[model samples]
Target: MPKLTIDGIEIEVEAGTSVLQACEALGIEVPRFCYHERLSVAGNCRMCLVDMERAPKPVASCCMPVGEGMVIRTDTERVRKARNGVMEFLLINHPLDCPICDQGGECDLQDQAVAYGKNTSRYDENKRAVKNKEFGPLIKTVMTRCIHCTRCIRFAEEIAGVPVLGATYRGENMEVGTYVEKTLDSELSGNLVDICPVGALTSKPYAFHARPWELRKFESIDAMDAVGSNIRVDVRGGQVMRVLPRLNEAVNEEWISDKTRHAVDGLMKRRLDKPYVRGADGKLKAASWDEAFAAIAKRVAGLDGSKIGAIAGNQADAESMLLLKELMQSLGVASIDCRQDGAKLDATTRAGYLFNTTIAGIEQADAVLLIGTNPRKEAAIINARLRKRWTMGGFPVGVIGPQIDLTYDHSYLGAGPQSLEALLKGEGEFAAKLKAAQRPMIIVGMGALTRADGAQVLAAARQLAEQVGAVAEGWNGFNVLHTAAARVGGLDLGLVPAAGGRDVAGILDGADKGEVEVVYLLGADEIDASRLGKAFVIYQGHHGDVGAHHADVILPGAAYTEKEGTYVNTEGRVQRGRKAAFAPGDAREDWAILRALSAHLAKTLPYDDLASVRRRLVEVNPAFAHVDDVAPSAWGAFGAAGAMDAAPFVTAIDNFYQTCAISRASATMAECTEAFVKGRQEEGKTGTHG
Candidate 1:
């Protein structure tokens, strides 16, 4: 430990702690453009210069390591002079366009210049202007405003694992670009806009939308994927203007994927704003909520509970899913499944289906094995963690299933059950590596466990894990990587098939065979609706996508951003998403719609409002009671234990941007998807042309 004094306030920090970190610990603010906590120290930005007693001049505090009994003065005259000179140099070639700049209200450089810069510039020379180049559809560039901080460059190379950005030319003529124009193809590219100190790289879609000061910010979580990255939704006039990342160290770590950041546009397009019932003419007629409910009740008037089934969607929250489960159970409806993809996941225990070691625990493992999952598309932030661990060295990662790029150096294993079996028998190369590792991890993706013989695959993976000592005294690294944000929460509430209940496929089969009279779809659009023959379908969701198109009656409901609910991440971290904006038009919250429908059926739910529903939810499942706390999973016997199946595991997500219904509806998301596909097509064409 080293004791350091900043402005006469003394404190002790661990060895090798930077002077900038020490000042932060003492509640001192050190202003600098190039210093970000997550990125490497560039030390090029000299705005954080501070005077030291034994030093000749003020030193850059960010790169200077603290020594024992070091005396630092942050408010000295020398430090002030250095900051003023640095500010002048930085603003010499910078543009004066704050009025039209998208980053005006939140610009770090603008704020710092006002506080520490000179009143007037001595230079009357012509300012250098650099022409902007196209980066992509998501980010717009104004090259003249760049301060050459290299934050974007470091982020692309280090964190994103894609060194797509670089600085070309000498200091005076230095230009930050891809050199040759290239689209920023990384899923985590949206973070560059947030890291930029000026308006150089602003959101292309939200360029002139609204200023930050005029928007109302609401804290929420990203339901785009299973990582459940924390976010702040900015709203203006009851509409979500943009989405930005919120700091959550346990899960997303202040970096959200592009889908999470740019999916807000979907909330405003192709929305189901009013209730509707299918008319005899085969057209959807606008109807009141009461009419929609009455039509549903009348359709299933004579049917028994065995003929009724409910299927929950991937984007549903825990609170709504709980109420839907309760309503179905009350009606003796045993056929209830949250998985729309017919995934045969083990719902018997939390450890059987959760990422048991948690996301933060990824750093501790010496060896990692990924099974049937492309984490870059499924959960980009978690993939970044693996990349970070690999960058730190001594971390060996192995992947089974698809040999696609995972943004890290991973030992590629074969793509199926036979490879897993070989590893279990200790007959493979990586099997020996896993056995030798002190802490080994096996992350099984939903892709491997969603097939006809999914249970067998899961069992084989578990057996391999046990054979390699992955679950030992000090470490439990048997993890299940989920792709949906609500899958774990649904499982926690016991929202699976009961004793005589059918799974998703079985439910659809019953409907197809006329054995089922009514099927309730709760935001479930991924299923093949044409297979759901003649059954009177009632869809409750916010989007008018595939589910709404096949529905007999549509009940308008709130989107994730328009409701307050709890969502469990892939790691069982329970996070509460607060309502950011009001529900559009005649749409009500999902739980409220469920409750109202329950009343129309003369089976009024116990809870009236969201608070009461939450209270009852906590009573039913104690995990729902612990907000932002991950309840440790107690492992039971694996339910899917069986013999080996020779089928190769498949990857779940194909298109990362257009996976969900909400994302598919957004024009912005659609544009992005088109661009990505077109870019790939162009690349293929060039390769063939060559």
Candidate 2:
């Protein structure tokens, strides 16, 4: 440990701690730019200059390491003069468009300028001007206002694992932009806008939308992916203006993917504001809630329990799924499934289907094997963690699936179950490495588990883990990387089919053969509508997507951002999201809609409000009551659970950007998807020609 004194206050810190961090620990404020806690120290922005007793001049506190018996002064005249000079130079070329800048109220440079900058500039020459370049549909640029902080550049290279962004030219002519006119193709590229100290980089979708001071912010959790990244929803007059990442060290680590950032636009498009019922003319006509509920009840009045089925979508919350399950049980409907992809997941134990080692455990892992999944597309933040671990060295990664560019070097074994079988048979090259690793991880994607022989693939993977000693004392790295945000929550609640109940595939087959009388879809849109046959479908969701198109009756429900609901991430960590905005006209919260429908059927649910519904959820699953907790459970064996079948593994997610109905309706997401596809095609061409 090193002892240091800041403004006459003495403190002792760890050996590698920076002077700025030491000052921060002592309740002393040290202003800085380009000094992100997660990124490498650049020491270019001289705003955090502090005077040291032994040093001849002021030093950049951000890069200066604390030494034993070192005395630093942050409120001295020399430090003040150095900070003022740095601020003046930074503002020499900055544009004076505070009133029009989107970051006017919350810019770090603006606050520092008011605190340390001189009243007027001393330069009489013309200020430098640089033309802004179009980065993409999500980010807007104003090159003239840049302060050369390089935070965006470091974030791109270090955090995002992409080196497209860099500085061009020398000295004052240097500007931050891509080497060519290319889009930032990283899934985590939206973080650059949040890291920029000035208005040079702002949200293109949120330009001139509203000031930060005028928006009402609410803490929430992201539903775009199964990682369940925490976020802050900013709303203006009942309309969501933007979405920003929240700091959760265990989950997102203060960073969110672009889909989670820009998917708010979908909330305003193709929304289901009122209920509708299909008429004899084969057209959905507007109807009151009473009429829609009556129509649904009439069709499902005398249906047998085995003939009725319900499916929950990927974006649904735990409360809504629980309420829907209760309603179905009350009406004697046992054919229910939340896994629309027909995944053969073993939900008897939490360790069987969860990311048992947790998200942060990736750093402690020395060896990793990805089976039939792309973390880069399915879970972007988790990919970042893998990249971080790989960057630190001694971390070997192997993949046994479609050979996609994971932004990291890994051994590409053959795809499908054969490769996994070879590893389990101790015939592969990486098998020895895994057996010798201290902590190894096996991440199974849903793609491998949704196929006909998914159970076999899962068993082989689990067997490989046990043989390699992956799960032992203090280390359990058997992970399931899910794509849907609601999959873990549904599985945690044991929302699978009961005995004699039909799964998703069986229900769809029954409906196609007219064996099923009625089908209820709770926001499910990924299934094929052509196989629904003549079954009377009742869609309850917030979007007018595929599920609504195939339904005979439509019930409008609130989105995740418009209702208070609980969601469990892939790690089995339960977290609740707060309501940030109201639902559209005639739309009610998802749980409320289910409760009302139950009443119309003369089977009034026990819960009346969100609290009671949550209570019921806790009663069914004790983990629901303890928010942000993963209850202890041991891993289960899957070898004798099923027989091996000869089938190749297949991924459920084809497009990363537009998976759910909400993201499908987002124009921003569509643009990103197009650009991403184009980039991938170009890369393919380059690979072939090379």
lDDT of 1 by residue, 346-376 (tens): 5787788888878999989989999888999
RMSD of 1: 1.5
TM-score to native of every candidate shown: 0.98, 0.98
Worst ten in a row by lDDT for model 1: 681-690
lDDT of 1 at 535: 89
Clashing pairs in 2: none
lDDT of 1 at 157: 90
Question: Could you give candidate 2's per-residue lDDT for residues 477-588 as a string of tens digits?
Answer: 8999998899999988778898888889988999999988799999999898788999999999999999999999999999999999899999988999999999999999
TM-score of 1: 0.98
Alpha carbon lDDT at 172, candidate 1: 78
Candidate number with greatest lDDT: 2
Span of 10 residues, lowest total lDDT, candidate 2: 638-647
